[model samples]
Target: MNTANPQLEGLYLALAAMNRLMVEKQLLTHEEIHETLAETEAAVMKNSALDGQSDSHRKAVAFPIRLLMTANEAAERGGEPTFEDLARQVGRTS
Candidate 1:
């Protein structure tokens, strides 16, 4: 889906609501949320520079979300999960 598409606004809102709920329920810490957002923004910026890109922002946003999902899944599987793990999963090595 296009990240800038107005039709997807509701989806973004819903996801934001769910994240807020997770914070309220202590399912995610404030630091984790902040780091997640930071990583997302970074992905967007990185992907935005692509030439002839049609949906760079959407693709960029998906990168971090995918990383988050992977980290969550790993954690659920009793594996060690960290922001670095998510970053690595998203190919954000430095």
Candidate 2:
């Protein structure tokens, strides 16, 4: 989206890399991460501050959640999945 934060791109990639590391190292299960992602999505969706925001504003805020969700999906499929792959899969293309 045009509202996407350019600076947060790194954070998105970092999240993917961290996910790969976590899975490779057996630090967390995919299901655990998915559960946490769901919890985060729920909490954000319930935030009062988001109630009056425009769609673009809300999507900007949801970028990280979308990234993680797609990244997790890619991981479930097998092999190393980068954040860029997740981004593309989630239609985050520039």
Candidate 3:
């Protein structure tokens, strides 16, 4: 969790915040977001396979997917999950 670049961390926070706002405004349901994230993740993984991408590359690409999925899960559980906490969960889950 050594974030050598601050912008990467900012992007993660921004994504999580955007998802939270969308759910809060009822523009998108938590279930909808979760389903979409799952689909996206599957597609990314499939493409990675086809392209013969390295495991490190695949995991790096999956970070945002995991971040969004974690955000949606936190929304469903009525919990405010931090970016660091979500990032840690993503690593463990991955």
Candidate 4:
């Protein structure tokens, strides 16, 4: 797949792997990750609005949180989903 930046793709992979390990190690539950990401997304969206950021900007800023949330959801479902899978889900559910 094409990406604007390769570094960003690497970052996403690293983050997803960390999240999976965290869940697997029982360091943090999926519910906790989901809740935290939800709260973060809300805060980012609100800040974006208050700062008069564009809709696209808001979505861009929230992308990582949404990706993590998607990963957590997939983990909760007992599936080792790919970054692409989580990314697609994030796009669909955004």
Highest TM-score: give the candidate number. 3
Estimate every model's Cα lDDT from 0 to 1: 0.57, 0.71, 0.85, 0.83
Candidate 4 lDDT over 1-94, as tens digits, reads 2577778767877887788789889998888888888999999999999999999899999998888788777778888677788778888987
lDDT of 3 by residue, 9-91 (tens): 78877887888898889899888889999999999988998999998888889888988898779878988777788888898
Instruction: Rank all candidate structures by their TM-score, best first, as comma-separated numbers.
Output: 3, 4, 2, 1
**Candidate 1 lDDT by residue in tens digits, 1-94:** 3346645545444554566568668899646866776687566656665544556455555654665555544544556455455556667532
Task: Identify the superior model by lDDT, candidate 1 or candidate 3.
Answer: 3
TM-score of each: 0.44, 0.71, 0.90, 0.88
- Scored against the true structure, residue 28 in model 1 reaches a CA lDDT of 91
Looking at model 3, residue 51 earns an lDDT score of 100
lDDT of 2 by residue, 14-39 (tens): 78779878977999888888889878
Rank list by lDDT: 3, 4, 2, 1
Clashing pairs in 2: none
Q: Supply the global lDDT for candidate 2.
A: 0.71
* Residue ranges of candidate 4 with Cα displaced over 4 Å: none
For each candidate, how many residue pairs have backbone atoms clashing (under 3 Å)?
Answer: 0, 0, 0, 0
TM-score of 1: 0.44
Off by over 4 Å in 2: 1-6, 48-51, 79-85, 92-94
